[model samples]
Target: MFVLSVLLLIAAVVLFLVGRGKERSASGWKLGAALSAVAGLLAGLFACVHVVSAYEVGVPVAFGKVGSPLTSGVHFKSPFTDVTSFSTRPVDLNLNDDDVVEVRSSQGGVLYADVTIKWAVVPAKAVGLYRLAGSEEAVEERLVLPDSREIIRNVFAKHTSEEGYASAREQIGSEIADLVKERLAPRGIDVTFVNLRNVRPSKKLQEQIDKKIQQEQATERATEASRTATAEAERKRIEAEGVARANKIIERSLSDKVLYNQCLEAYKEAAKAHPVYAVPCGTDSNGTPVIVDGSKSG
Candidate 1:
């Protein structure tokens, strides 16, 4: 558009020179000159207009100097200025195993985190972004990716290796998101959220973790066995005490008359089987029964 406007203006200048301010032919040339000049100025005006899209904010730059941002609509600027549009849409910057972030836990154990951060350049801050980082790619390189990776590492560093690997992973992600947002807001990056996934200990750290887990499992099994044995011993003790109590109760309940009846019943049963008769003998001082089994003479 700038080139077109310049060409039109040149045409107007050539027509005005051809008129030379003279006769009928000159007068006609002069009219043509006036029309061409007007058309040129209109073209120049058209060249100044910039259309910013709904999801974009444009910053005008002329000869290395940055201008105020243009919002989502038509705006006019110096025809010499070029508008650079920055997207305000959320974009994913996934740092998977391909870009794993190395973190040292508080316990000095090493691990890696696979992170995905959703972020966008703030529309109102687009001018600042232009001043700081020129392109969207530059913003990620200089501000977004590096800053987020460092924040993730720092947040994970505050926890033990286990927390980074599994235990407090969600909490670590939240912390990372908060820190990245806080750190990059002034730099014109709006971090929506940080997702930490596929986190695990480093190779050496993993071997150590596996060993620790195996030891814990063994200790648990031993403790359970000990508990079971103690319970069994307690149950046997209770059973023996019950049996002893039962015997004592039976001994206390028996009297001399009870013993004598039991003996008599036994003798009667024997007589039933062998025709024997039970003959009572005098009891001793303790008064237990004495009985003799006599066979019936046939």
Candidate 2:
């Protein structure tokens, strides 16, 4: 557009000069000159005016050299210079199953991860970014993607497959984001956030982890059962000891006189229940009691 405007302006100048020199065809030349001038003015206005959206920053290029950055809103530049706009808003780059990254674990097991990186070009560095990286797509392709993959691989290599799938997943992502930020900040890209959406170990590794967990649970249960059985045996032993102690106290209280009195009371109770009865008067040979009926003794 700028080139066409310059061409139209040149044509108008040529026509105006020719009109002034001619006497008979001067009005025709003047009319053509006026039209050309109007066209050139509109084109020049169009080329010089630029609107940078709220989310975008513009970089102006003069001839072949890159110029300063332009913030959001209307801006004016030379019609000869071109302004290129790039979004300053956060952009999400997802690397999922479709673009899964394979990495090795500390234990030499393979792991796959799905990740996302949220980033944007630094607004102040728009012109420098354009000069260095060309475009947003180019920045992602040349810098973001390769750097993210490399950082992830390096971080994952420091962890085991179980760690990748479990406790260390988030930490791994954070480390990647930090490293990538350090690597790209000097180049005008800002790494805002990184997410390790999913990490999966190989099928064999997963099965082994599951088995190990089951074995640990079983061992815990067995330990608990052993503790319970030992407590029960201790309780039974204490109860038996108490019963034996009570028996010993009772046996120590008994005497020969108490036993003779008890035997006499039993014989008296039996005599009241029967006219003729046998009773134990005393102990005879072999410690056996000798009983005689009252009628047989008479």
Candidate 3:
């Protein structure tokens, strides 16, 4: 469009110059020039306009040198310059089975991790980013992905296979994001978040881990049962001791007269209920009487 407008302006100039030498055709040539000039101006106006979306930032480059960043909305630049847009919103880069990362665990086991990283180009440094990283695609290829792989390896290396598989998986992701951000922030990439979707150890290691977990659970149950049984036994022993102590107190408090009176009262109460078939044995030196069965006397 800019080229066409420039051509139209040149044609208008030629027509106006040619009209100077003509007499009868001069008015027609002037009118044509005026219309062409208006059309050319409109075309040039349209050519220099560029609209940056709300979620993007545009960097203008003229003659291979970067210019001021163009924020969202309409921007005007020389027709010869170029504007490149980079997304300012968070972008997700998934590292899954198609591009899985392999790392070694603290236990020296091989592990596979599927991760995703959310990031964006810092708007303030977008021009610098373009100069250094070229474009958004280039930034991801040259910086985000490689850094993500390296960070994952470094973070997972600090954890055992079981930790990577389950226990510290979230921690590993957070550490990776932090480390990657620290490393890439200076390079104009802002790391927002990282997700470790799946991290798997070898099948053999997984089976061993499952068995170990089951064994630990079983041991915990057994320990709890033993503790309960020991508590019940202690309780019974205490009850027996209390009963024996009460019996001893009763025996020590009773004298010959008290024993005689208690035996008489017991005999009266028993006689009222049924026939008495026991003989009162004489008191011992302890002054506690004993009963002798009449049926066994023979």
Per-residue lDDT of candidate 2, residues 115-134 (tens digit): 98999999998877787678
RMSD of each: 5.2, 5.0, 6.7
- Candidate that would win on TM-score: 1
True-vs-predicted CA distance for residue 296, candidate 2, Å = 15
lDDT agreement of model 2 with the native: 0.86
Residues 39-94 of candidate 1: C-alpha lDDT, one tens digit per residue = 88888998899899999999999888888888899998888999999999998898
Q: State the lDDT of candidate 3 residue by residue for 1-298, as single tens digits.
A: 8898998898888888888779899998988888888889988988899899998999999889899888999988798878889999999999987799988898888888999889999889898889878889998998899888988998888999888888887788888878988998998788888888898877777777789899999999999999999999999999999999999999999986787777888876765666554345356676554554444446
lDDT of 3 at 17: 83
Report the error of model 3 at residue 41, Å.
2.5
| Residue pairs in clash, model 3 | none
lDDT of each: 0.85, 0.86, 0.86
Of candidate 3, the 10-residue stretch with the lowest lDDT total is 288-297
Better of 1 and 2 by TM-score: 1
